[model samples]
Target: MDRARKDMIVKEILYWKDNRMLPEHYCDYLLALYTEGNRPKDKARKAKGFYFLNIILLLLIPLSLLFIYFTELSFILQMGLLIFFTITGVSLAIYFTNKGIAPQLPLAVSALILLLISVEMASHFFPHHNTALYGALMLNCLLWIAAAWKFRQHYFGISGLVGLIIIVISIFI
Candidate 1:
């Protein structure tokens, strides 16, 4: 084949790999056959950076929990920190999902952070209202179920259903 044709094929294969239009192994094999084993170097570097960023984002989950439980910061400051962490987690999740990377960890972390934020804010604002707290929990569970449907994740749905059951039991007993 001509050089132009080969280059076009390689670019197409790269696009397939990046967007997950084809399985990664298939894309790799095609790229290797087309490029004669000279794959792009920058992809490896970018992958390393993404891996590092993923680790940092994962670490932020635990750090946010610690900040919420251990610190004595003012309520506004705590809320600000939580919002920042939640936004970062959610943004990373969306980016990873679009790039065909493993997005489950970031998505799960964001959901957990959101749950914490909702519960904490509800309890803080309605310290004496058990009904309000239950409402907040129920709302979070519904959000999880909605997210599960949107994302096609069974675990999220199961967890939300279980949460609803538990909340109902608590309310009765």
Candidate 2:
């Protein structure tokens, strides 16, 4: 309402947030206020959280999921995929953990595209070894499931379905 009222409100929020005594909803409220210039510090903290969360989601989650899809150790074909995801995920996490880095969405998407290619490459590697192929496919399905849950991305949901189909087809083919 007035400057004094606003200052008091802001101070109370800071006290609650700093003390960790506030509910997550309160943090959300602060985040909204901060985003709207209601409070500067809270906005900064919210932005920091988002920056790191992007790292975790765009890079971390996928990397962590695909890490299990190891095909060849020597050629490093599948391990390559694992490494690709791990590196990008870790890099993003590092890049934005402390401060916002004005993340390049294109780079992240490009890395993801490569990661997808790696999965296809891995699948092709063990065509004869149905056991390995199917097991890896199952892992892929679960990974997509997690992705779908976290991101609500239709691609993930579809990818998960494809993984299931691939696993089933491998048994017959």
Clashing pairs in 1: none
lDDT (Cα, tens digit) per residue for candidate 1, span 14-133: 888878899999998899899999877667877898989889888987888888899899888888998898899889888987776877778788888888898899889999999988
| TM-score: model 1 vs. ground truth | 0.76
Badly placed stretches (over 4 Å) of model 1 are: 1-36, 40-47
lDDT of 2: 0.59
Query: lDDT, candidate 2, residue 22?
Result: 79
Candidate 2 TM-score versus the reference: 0.38
lDDT (Cα, tens digit) per residue for candidate 2, span 1-173? 67777677677777776566877577658756744554454577767877666655566445444544442344455556556665665465455533435434423453455445556555668656657656766776777667667645566677788868877886887
What would the TM-scores of all predictions be? 0.76, 0.38
